[model samples]
Target: MRELTRDDVNAAVKGGSVFASGGGGWVDHGLEIGHAALSIGRPKLLSVDELPDDAIILTCTAIGAPAGRDWQMLGKDYIKAVQLIIENYDGKIAGVMTPQNGMSSTINGWLPAAALGLAVIDATGDIRAHPTGKMGSLGLASSIDYETIQAVAGGKPEIGSYMELVVKGTPARTSNILRTASDMAGGFIAAARHPLPIKHIKKHAAIGGISIAIELGRVIMEAEPDGPEAVLEAVVHKTNGRILGRGTVTTKNVHYSGAFDVGTIEVSIPNRRLTLHVMNEYMAVGDDEGTRLTTFPDVITTFDLKKGLPVSVGDVEEGMEIAVFAIDKSKVPLSSSVKDPTVYPEVEEMLGIDLQSYAFDKEKTIYA
Candidate 1:
């Protein structure tokens, strides 16, 4: 097995997450909070090829709304949710596995490496992020059973806080519970789904996302002003992506209605000005010159112009002074529910004056 250093993990998270599609949540924050536990044990790169078939495994992931994740609603929820799920199973956990790609999935999958004191499997079932466990090809695969139980903090019982999925219906039930639980925590959730055979996990998950986040975070932190561009350059090139645009928010037209943080960000650069519409996650980006950018199956994120760090949708404030960038989703694939029209059709529709006219761009999209 290849032995990856601490710094290598950081580079990978920073670089790997550029592909996270905005739905992966922010890699910066998670990176900042990670490693304290991981540093405890010199985590090893356990190879999938070396894993045994009979090894009992437990699955865990960071669960919460991406929208809430930025606001610090995800920490305890990730550990608690997985602890509860593992508790439900009467079997012993021989090892662990991650779900797949995206900043959210990467962070969720790897967080356990340090906290649980378990060996990190090299791969996961799906290669990218999917909103619900039912959607992954693994949900249909043999070996992993879906029997589940759901619990919610409150609200409609049909939308159980947590759901119970039987072996025959584990896949569908988990999918339903995944959305329901996330919404309960304020429209997002983290879940360890489709527990793969220990060996299979070694075959798919983009290993080292946790380490990448930490490394990326440290790089951003170590670099002072004028660092955003360098951090962006390192991440973009490492992930094989391009920087969509970088500009400051000149105006933030924010209005609060219900549980949503709704608004528009008008940004200005030396040469041009751009506008971004946000709801939960950033929906769309456009320029007065008519360069309209929509994210679906791709991610859109806003960051500090001088610092190159990211902030969440729930925490956005007016005139915060920031730079906005769009990451292509074709790199880190999420689910249709997440990348669908409902996530952010405004880039096309709001700009076009018609909603349905801008269908969800399922070809790999993400938004800030």
Candidate 2:
């Protein structure tokens, strides 16, 4: 186990943004929580193997649309969410883990861990940012007998939107309730849920995912002084990813719906146009002729060519110059949750695209 430094926080936000796949959480929010954690206490990061098999681990995450305007989640809200879990749960919680890697999501557990004196486990529900809590449930969605305990706290108190809730039910039913609570809390909320044994997390999570984000961030930060090209090149080399297209955004149509940012973005390349389908994050990228270039579970993210930062769907304007990058799912460490067929149908139905064909092929070895 090791204590996280300010440099590690910077690296996490930078690298976590890339793994965010366009919609993990806001960059500023990530930095805020990360720095706050360091200010209060030294948060230790532990590998899955470091913990006892019987230790209970909880997932801390922010739920709701990244683009929501009235969203009001603060550092206190994150701490409160975890406190609620600790107060209500029967066992002694060992540590906290993030549901996925995102600009902010990557460090979701840091503040809670530091302030509460718990370890930050290096495992994650999903290596990349994905929509819905179910996608980050680490295949608990398939366990019919599993009961989920979810705690949520967020929203602006002055606006009468702040609220706290604790629920117990099936994963699907409880997750949907949280989504509804997010909307009621003005579109965003912090959540702590699904305590499980360390052994189960070791078996189902994307191990070492925190290190992946930190390493990627360190590479990006080191290359920043060189130029955008250098940073992009360094990212490509690090993730074994390739630039899909580089061009100006010609059109962007994003809107908040059902606690999600759903829409499309069109970018004009030299001779063709690329379309990015969105449902909170960039779900898929396709050419004008309808040829799918990359799909979700694969890392699909956009970088502001001028700023050398990964830009989320909400920030991409019609005139900005950006480069789209993709790392095949085969290239990243994937948790069993992303590979479970049970989680794809809702997303597929929402986006009206085929994901199961690519995400869950019987012949592919996703979790070796």
Candidate whose TM-score is highest: 2
Clashes of each: 47, 0
TM-score, cand. 1 vs. native: 0.62
What is candidate 2's lDDT per residue for 226-299, written digit by digit as tens?
A: 99999999999999999998999999988888898887899998889998999999988888876778887889
Residue by residue across 64-89, what tens digits does model 1's lDDT show? 44434222334445555556556665
* Candidate 2 segments exceeding 4 Å error: 362-368
Cα lDDT listed for each candidate: 0.48, 0.92
Clashes of 1: 47
